[model samples]
Target: MHEISVAAALMRRVLAEKEARKLERISQIVLQIGPMSGIMPDALQFAYDSLREGTQLEGTELVIHSAELTTCCRHCLHLFDSRLMHTRCPRCGSEELQIMGGDEFFIQYLVTEKV
Candidate 1:
């Protein structure tokens, strides 16, 4: 699964941050994952758990926050957010839409132990 690679990359960034900040221990990692990001949270968590074994992040908690899908109607220029997928704009019923958000995969923040 590609989640392994994703997890590996995330781990690399986390390690870099830890080293850069000279952190003693990382307690948690908060992630913002969009519904349309094509990332399975369970699979990503499993991959992260497997990859962190025997590493500095072994016990680090992985927290995932599901982001809402936001879209704008091309015809009406109306913006709306939803957890479900929509083919048309709710305001104008136009098929033409611009996706404003809900296709993201990024680290939001990290919780670390203090010295």
Candidate 2:
């Protein structure tokens, strides 16, 4: 699955950071995932669990946080949550909309043991 590649990339970054800091082990990794990021948290965790074997992150915990979807109406200047999956403005019913968030996937922080 695509989550495997994503997990691999994430581990690469974490490993780089761990090396730079000379950390002995990672305890936790916090990730913020947007609703539209197209990543399943379960799959990500599974991928991480599989990939972390025998590595610095072997016993690391993967924590995921959800980011809300927001959109701005280009016609009415209204901003609102898009959890309803509506493509238009809820206030003015305008079809012109600009998505502001909910397509993000990034690592927020990590907890590690210093060497």
Best-matching candidate per lDDT: 1
Clashing pairs in 2: none
Separately for all candidates shown, the number of backbone clashes (residues 3 or more apart, or on different chains) is 0, 0
TM-score of each: 0.83, 0.81
Tens-place lDDT digits, model 1, residues 28-99: 999999989989889999999999999999989999998888888899999999877789998889999888
lDDT of 2 by residue, 3-115 (tens): 99999999999999988988887899999999889998889999999999998788899999988888899998998886557777879999998888788899999987766
Error of 2 at 59 (Å): 0.9
Model 1: lDDT to the true structure: 0.92
> How many residue pairs in model 1 have overlapping backbones?
0
In model 2, which regions exceed 4 Å deviation? none
